[model samples]
Target: MIPLDRFSGHANLYAQYRIDYPPDLYNYLLSFVTERRAAWDCATGNGQVADVLANSFDQVDATDISETQLILAAKKPNIRYQLSQAEQTPFANQTFDLITVAQALHWFTIDAFHQEVRRVAKPGAILAEWGYGLVKLGSDLDAVLLDFYRNRVGPYWDPQRVHIDTSYANLPFPFADVQHNQFTIHRNWTLDRFLNYLRTWSAVRQYIHENEEDPVTDFGEQLKAHWGEGEREIRFPVFFRLGRVMDEPVQ
Candidate 1:
């Protein structure tokens, strides 16, 4: 997992360009929790998930290892931001009605994160761990962008890491009857917004810096040449996995 320190530089761009979870995804997650439930949002970057969680839960506590990210997230009145890592949440045992980890779960140590989640979550609580795949643009121009990610960006991703799987099966959480869902969201973005989003990727940034390939100058040209730039909206698939933590004691 890339360290949180690496994210500090791009935190603002990340908050802007990173796609948000579909509203339906949050509605589905909220269906399992009762009204006014207490929820914890782990690895809550910029409090985006926590902001969504707050709409349903009476109390939402969000924590992240990056203080820089948390600082940007502190604007929300309903969310309590803490500079804490996912492996060691600073909350009491069996206290939360729900625990959520969004795109950031892939960066965590699964064993330790699960243990902490189990310790802090109440009996019958739901653990919703979710992430989205890269946005797909149907045009050939989109193919160029995808190729960049697949060949350049994806190489740094650890194949042995088990966290990328969107499935809840085989997770260390004390849970039963795991389920999954997929949905699509459409967003209208200007060319600048799109390029800014691309620049937020760590691997893309690293590749450009190492090779002296200016991502903005080169990639921007490629995109403009292909798409003949203007404002456009793109639809992308987002995935969610939800599991119920058993009411019974862990064996």
Candidate 2:
């Protein structure tokens, strides 16, 4: 069994501060899915994408290995939240119209998860995965944020993080490729809200675990002092990959 890396502790911060993907992102993905019947969102992290899918699909199965994260997810009548891993799931063959992983695909065991994807997805079903990298604030605050992300807590990031940093271009996707337009997560937030989002970073959690120091404390101080107390719009360039499941499963 693959060991579970729990991010449940970060769930609250994640639900509160992390910007949800825009409607255009879903609209683009929905175009590829032939049917809006059933969809599976693996590693559904607080049901961010799953919640969005619920509006378009008749039924949405949202799965995550972290129970704590699920507890924080907003409940909806059409959404079912379950605890399951991405690489190995109890779902049956050809069970879904679309499959999505948002910001969490890098953590999956790619080969195993790809096999599962083939088993669960119907022929021509759409498979979409995406992640967002470095937020764009203004130049000054952006520089400080970069230092905190790269220099302060870089080592603590999971090796899988490189996939996101590089925009999942290197990811081994075992599916028929589908070209897609660019999507960005654009939103406005107060400085406090943005800092809260940073605290949800896994590397930030690791930095705290190893050093017993809250790196955000210093960074937050500097950010507050420099930017003053106000809100600003932030944009995170979202990197996404789209593809269609093959009709025949790989043996």
Candidate 3:
């Protein structure tokens, strides 16, 4: 993957604006494990997944490349936040019972990360990676957002974004695979809140820096027009791929 510093530019925005993982996501992962010894949240931007893992696991190690983002991550007694890359980490081999990557796997060097996961993950360790794509808010609002996403700042998105666009169906997952039904996170938010979330997009930030323009600002009028000046239920479709780490080496 092409390396980029996507989140540091707006670490505070990232912390304040990003949505939460569905509460039941942790339960789905836990179902595969016999023991809740420890879990690693890789590419753990703001410890979103790590925080969830902490509630169940005895210990949670969350790693990210950005110290700025790590600083904003939620603090918990059972969670340890580290400035580390997804492809390389300081943890010892075969140490984790579960490893989850939430919404940030697309930024990783997938093959190398798979190797790192194999090294740190215990035999039969559950490895789950999930991401949410464009939020659905009915056709009227959806069309406006998709126009901005696909045509406005589409060029700025990383190549890995396609994996998310397709719900990670073709992501190179090197493990003994498992299946889970589709998951979606639903929230009710005002148009202002939704716009704040949109402003947190890496592409949106890049567009602002490159062109000195905030497209979302111009788009807001259209959004508010369609949204009808009230709270609306937004659905964030989550795509997940779960697998069990094999006893043998990745090679």
Q: Which candidate is the best by lDDT?
A: 3
The local distance difference test score of each candidate is 0.74, 0.84, 0.85
**Full ranking by TM-score:** 3, 2, 1
Stretch of 10 with least lDDT, candidate 3: 173-182
Per residue, candidate 1 scores C-alpha lDDT tens digits across 74-185 of 4556778888888886799988989999877667778778878778888778888877666766676667877776765666444422344434345555467677888888
Give a tens-digit lDDT track for model 3, residues 145-196.
7898999989977787898898877767767866655688899988888888
**Can you give the TM-score per candidate against the true fold?**
0.88, 0.94, 0.95
Clashes of each: 0, 0, 0
TM value for model 2: 0.94
lDDT of 2 by residue, 1-251 (tens): 67456588778888887778888888788877779899999988888788888988999999998888899987889999988889878888999999999888888888889889989988888889888898998776788788878898998998888998888888777677666556877787887788788888899998998899989888888887766777787789998889889875433
Error of 1 at 99 (Å): 0.8
CA-RMSD of model 1: 2.8
Question: Where is model 3 more than 4 Å wrong at Cα?
Answer: 249-251
Give lDDT for model 1.
Answer: 0.74
Off by over 4 Å in 1: 1-5, 156-174, 247-251
